[model samples]
Target: MVPTIEMTTTWERTCELDDLEPGWGEVALLGARQVALVRVGGEEVYAVDHHDPHTGAPVMARGIVGSRGDRPTIASPLHKQVYDLGTGACFTDASLALRTYRTRVVGGMIEVELDA
Candidate 1:
């Protein structure tokens, strides 16, 4: 596994898990950068860097979620580039990817793991 950087100090609560409805996404600041918190299939949740990996634009959070083969991914709204939510890997281009953050729900609150 690639070394996961400590994105924040402690797990900061962004919102309630219920706030992110299934098949939808929400944008929140996770430390110094914005992140897109996506809820897929009503069971899986993903937190990825909000910027589009291909264009460096703050648009990933607004992308659409879909599946390719057996993997779930998001398509950038600008250029339609897709990114794997689990690994932040761009589906079409191996040289590009976004940063991913670890997250969990605590007492109904959505928390993003971070460094102290």
Candidate 2:
């Protein structure tokens, strides 16, 4: 597992827009940790910790993505746990949440922000 701090701040290229399939997520190693790169919607991508904070399992990537009152979040497949995409806070339980990384499109490539 890679440190959450490193993955959150480092920029890594996981895949291209056409390379990612909708409704699915891919795991990438960032500075010794595994992170989930998800294609939530059309041309929209998100990065989150592969591990589910609620179950302690690396399965957040397999979760579904949707919005809850304008907030983007992923629903864990293990226990149906919901987490905020921007802040990585568990919606169901504020205390439990996986870590999220900063994602953006730069020069037509999807990049994740890693720690400095």
Candidate 3:
């Protein structure tokens, strides 16, 4: 049997890193999905679904950027539901979860790896 090779071509370029403001979230369109690109500090970035799981509203980009202890978090602007930026786990509601995407910065450009 031949060895299978993993491909890293799923990463899609979204926007320039300079376009994002630190401690704020920006909305980016990746194909048919709306992703929220969040910039923390300087180089640290995270990508999560722009849709709020609780209200089904595409307003996550306006969510407040904050932290719960060491874990980075975003609080929904509507109901103030907190979610982990790393794991997309809902801290306020155990039953709700936001989708997370892998993000990387290359040559000052931000790329997001969407789920297949």
- Whole-model lDDT values for every prediction: 0.83, 0.81, 0.93
Collision count for each candidate, in order: 1, 8, 0
lDDT head-to-head 1 vs 2, winner: 1
- Once fitted onto the true fold, the runs of candidate 3 whose alpha carbons sit more than 4 angstroms away are 1-9
Q: Which residue pairs show collisions in model 2?
A: 2-32, 2-33, 9-113, 9-114, 9-115, 10-113, 10-114, 10-115
Model 2's lDDT to the true fold? 0.81
Model 2 residue 71 CA deviation (Å) reads 1.4
Sorting all predicted structures by TM-score, with the top scorer first, yields 3, 1, 2
Best by lDDT: 3
For model 1, give the 10-residue run with minimal summed lDDT.
5-14
lDDT by residue (tens digit), candidate 2, 38-84? 88677788888998897788887788878799888889988898888
In candidate 3, where is summed lDDT lowest over 10 consecutive residues?
5-14
Q: List TM-score per model, in order.
A: 0.85, 0.81, 0.91
List the RMSD of every prediction in angstroms: 4.5, 5.8, 2.7
Cα deviation at 114, candidate 1, in Å, is 2.7
TM-score of 3: 0.91
User: Model 3, clash count?
Assistant: 0
